[model samples]
Target: MNEKLHCIGCGTEIQTENPQEPGYAPVSSLEKEDIICKRCFRLKNYNELQPVSLTDDDFLRILNGLGTQKGLIVKIVDIFDFNGSWLPGLHRFVGSNPVLLIANKVDLLPKSVNKNKVINWIKQEAKNLGLKPIDVLLVSAHKGSGMTEAMEAIEHYRRGEDVYVVGCTNVGKSTFINRIIKTATGTGDIITTSHFPGTTLDMIEIPLDDKKAIFDTPGIINHHQMAHYLDPSELKFIMPKKEIKPKTFQLNAGQTLFVGALARFDFIQGQRAAFTVHIANDLDIHRTKLEKADELYANHRGELLAPPSEKYIDQLPRLVRHEFSIKEAKTDIVFSGLGWITIQDTNCVIAAYAPEGVEVQVRPSLI
Candidate 1:
């Protein structure tokens, strides 16, 4: 028929070649009764993960167009990886549109953590970035936590206007919207959800009412995310699906901890102190002497350290060091998309190492 077809799951145009790209289906599959791209097909049937390929310019173009459209912006962010999930210059693209910050994956936080404190911290961080959200709500899209509050906030702020949901890739926007759809319509149909970036290539709209609609925008591609570097099987080891049980290590000077061979935390000049790590429970962590850390990593990265899988080892960037000296309050050394370590020690000198371009930030402790 030579007719153009789009995947109903994510709205990406279907093609036969380029399996790495979005909306790719086999020629045989295209001739079938129900046409879905390989990404959607695997996600729906086998529950497999695939990377989404979209350029930074493409995401910026989609976001820039929102400035001219009249709608409420619902910015969904992964609570576990806040910095990695946040789109840079979000305020500039929205052009004064009221933003409702929806922090997804709140269920992943430790049970001992206070929600109010986390919300305040998120607000402060947004304020520092010049993003003044009209409201902030924490929700676990995967578990249906806080979906009602999110809906109420959207309804209240949207005021019968269109609602635009946006965020960086792997932020769980599709899952969040799917929950909203099911909640509002009592339908079991779900939009495709995957750990990979660029899952949504075009906008998918759900009618909220005759006068209003909620739009799910494609996730903005951020090159700085660790997800871009790891294989799909490795993602489960790093991406926390449950509450993170804090792992504390008592370290003396000249010690190092390897976070799955992807990051290193060195106790350069710290006194005998405790460092609390918050990362996926399944990921392996190894401790060794700082002097021999490099030798160990080079010798047995994929075997002992892991997740720079053998296939991706050559493509992984060299570890770049970021040194920090903490003299005051507790601080979190965040490795974007990986997790963070919180340390509270006076006159402590430490250093964090991660693949080049993956952000390693030092921020005031949220706990």
Candidate 2:
């Protein structure tokens, strides 16, 4: 019989019998110092599943403290799901402090798109959203790509300052911090990085020797995120990952598309607009004519449409619609959690949908 221990990642006590939760370890490995077992280890090292949710109040309390400190604020963003991973009201929370934005998951973009261009675009986009970040670095937190550069940036700006890593849940925030831990310090720290979702429920500070330290806060779980309503099996089908090969569908007015039950997009006006979808590479996307979409969705939501499965179906609200005209330069009809439909710089009427209570807003297109 194997004894159990708490997981190094989430500090959850383990039973070893149930492999479903974090911290599952055997008696031999249970007492190990860095006892993060296979489950948490995979989630931390690879981009594996460790779904945990946090509340808004808990998230805001952590942010409010950042302004009082004198450290570099490293704001992280998901390159694959940029819109979904950005925290709203972040600018107000950080105050006048200098901010460095790191667009994480760079490995997930199109090969043709220049990496520098994407970083620049994110920098500009951040400003338009009222956040004047001091610098922006692109990195693939999963593969340790550009992590050194990000560290250099953090070190240069840190100036013996406290560091705050900010990102919405699932933007590789924990992974990036772990990288920061390994490179900046070494592999000897006791409280190391392993993914178990928002590991730092409160602000967990790791000292940079005696003078400086990195403060990691619990990831702010967007109440609007699909992850909250989704099971582990469902998220893989909905979220996009690497180099989003934009799925394009020519839609006549009154056509509907479902982004794995996370969002519904309907073409309401204009001459057959080109609907460009950006999502995780793994998720299944289904489309049908508006007249039949509702019926199809009802019949095949869990089987075909997926994500918000029948188990969580009743939890999902009736999809609400927001009608808007793309009057600005290349506006993206941002859907919470799923991804966005890039509307080219043209005037067109579009209707967007998500489960009720999740706020959806359009921003300048990234591409």
Candidate 3:
């Protein structure tokens, strides 16, 4: 049993013990010519992922190494959770390498949403966050939309140099790389794709025609993600699978809308206006008076409100409120990884809430 041996599926060093950890394989499987760890095995066959995480130190070491290497950085992000999936300060870590931003999961957005507007917004947000990317493109890695364009962009920007694909956990970095493998080598599923964070344990490289390579780096887990605060079973309810149908609620001041038990949006001060919710359609939304919101949530957070489902309710931190005064028209109140609510009317006061560590902020309407 050589501890140095890595899983062919995820590149984590193989170990016989600790099934709960990465690279866990049965001793019986050691004789096989190509052995994937238990995690990848389940993902490949059952399409079910068991959640696992890596230490920040582990990812920091990987990212810091990028600064010393020469390559084009291909940064993937979830369009539905752009801020949550973003690797903050990535520009400083990649040295002078040009970053090509790939915003994945475009298929989950509403059909009415303008693609160019989304691209522009992403570019502005990248600049605001100190990342000046060479280009920004949107694609649905799962559905293959804009993937050809994405591939072309990578080829053009890399310019015979190595390419490094990086992003926070659950942003479809692995899926994006799998698409490349399928196209380049006519082989697929070389890497594991899962809902779990830190699916890729180590850097896996794919050789280009010119002997250059594209490296798939391990996903850095963002603590502020709503995924970290919910049970895996609840993840499906929050992570949208199909195109979203914008649900608009007409409300006056002093009304509250609960997006499952994961987030809350309150119209504190505004004229009667339309509040359009852009979230996973499977997740339930409950509207109530602002005054009764506190009492309702306190009484039925895991039941009537749903999601944490009582069994895992204690795992979530207490909700923390973030207030905003919307001066700009069509402002969106984003609940990090969960989703967002758009306010079309200006001069409105709003308050959003999420689990203590999760982020809630306002931005220009993405649609």
Candidate 4:
């Protein structure tokens, strides 16, 4: 009896069963030859990249296994999406390991933005989440910004100890790891790439020195991130560029601004100083009176005030609002995956709303 086979990449027939042959489908996917496995076609085309996925169970097991090992945690997080970019139970996994937080994507902020303030914000957020990072380093894995500071801090903090890099999915953990790899070994073969979810599952280790090395762990799934709902092109709309241009708007009380459905800020009361927005250049920011915010959101939500496409809105969990009253210098009110609002020195209360599972926070304004 002959069986059928298929490729996972571009569904097609498998002409041969040789282990190394093209169009080779896993035994599990063999039932449907018309549905070619991606691996086969990717190898055949030699143009695309293959992604590795880790199951939730496998992910937990790996984290648990790390307990028996020794290392310092270098938690990498996306600055634009700080709230949604944390490890949920990392403290438990790394117990007293002395973690150092690396806030990636600093290049996405305004050129004049104060980086120290962003670092301070990361510390504050870490404190709020019951995480105690000995230090926080700002970096841009893509543009290599802050890489030196981050590497120096890691070297100092680790102090001959192993380093473990962890973060939620889409926070650029892999790229950050690649940057470290390039600097440490002058190569980029250490990490993998992908567009879908659950890219890294097992812990891939890289030796920093002969005895002391670092570990690169896969990213955990963050369901609430706006990126999950967006297509690749759409996602680019939110991911910041190498350089960011802050958009400043002067407004009085009763004004609202939308930062891609990932965040909505309603300026209710205060002497409005200019609210500068630092977000993905492609992401749109619209302003309106606070009174008409709800109406405007309801009317133009998925469209003008997009991100939560009608499908995303219907499937997405309810949005929860976090109220913050700012009374001070420049402050960054961060909506994970969305963008941040720079509240100038002044007293004002603002309410930000995001999907249920996402995290929203405020940091000392870096600008």
lDDT of 4 by residue, 154-220 (tens): 8888868777777777777767876676677654343332211222222445666656767666566
Q: Considering every candidate listed, which one attains the maximal lDDT?
A: 3
Residue 226 CA displacement from its true place in model 3, Å: 0.6
Ranking by lDDT: 3, 1, 2, 4
- For all candidates in order, the CA lDDT equals 0.81, 0.70, 0.83, 0.68
Tell me the lDDT of model 4 at 25. 52
lDDT of 1 at 220: 71
TM-score leader: 3
lDDT minimum window of 10 residues, candidate 2: 193-202
Task: Write the residue-wise lDDT of candidate 2 on 1-367 in tens digits.
Answer: 3454566666666556655433456657765677765555654565333433456665767777777667788898876666667787788988767898898877776665566667777877787778988888889988888988888888788877778877877888878876765665554434344232333343445667656777676667775565656676667766655567877777788888887767888887777667788777666678888889779877877667767777877677777889897777567776666667877647678788887866577766656
Error of 3 at 73 (Å): 0.5
Candidate 3 C-alpha lDDT tens digits along 5-28: 787777678898887567899999
lDDT of 1 by residue, 179-200 (tens): 7766665543343332223334
Q: Number of clashing residue pairs in every model?
A: 0, 8, 0, 15
Runs with alpha carbons beyond 4 Å of true place in candidate 3: 1-12, 16-20, 30-52, 188-201
Model 3: lDDT of residue 282: 86
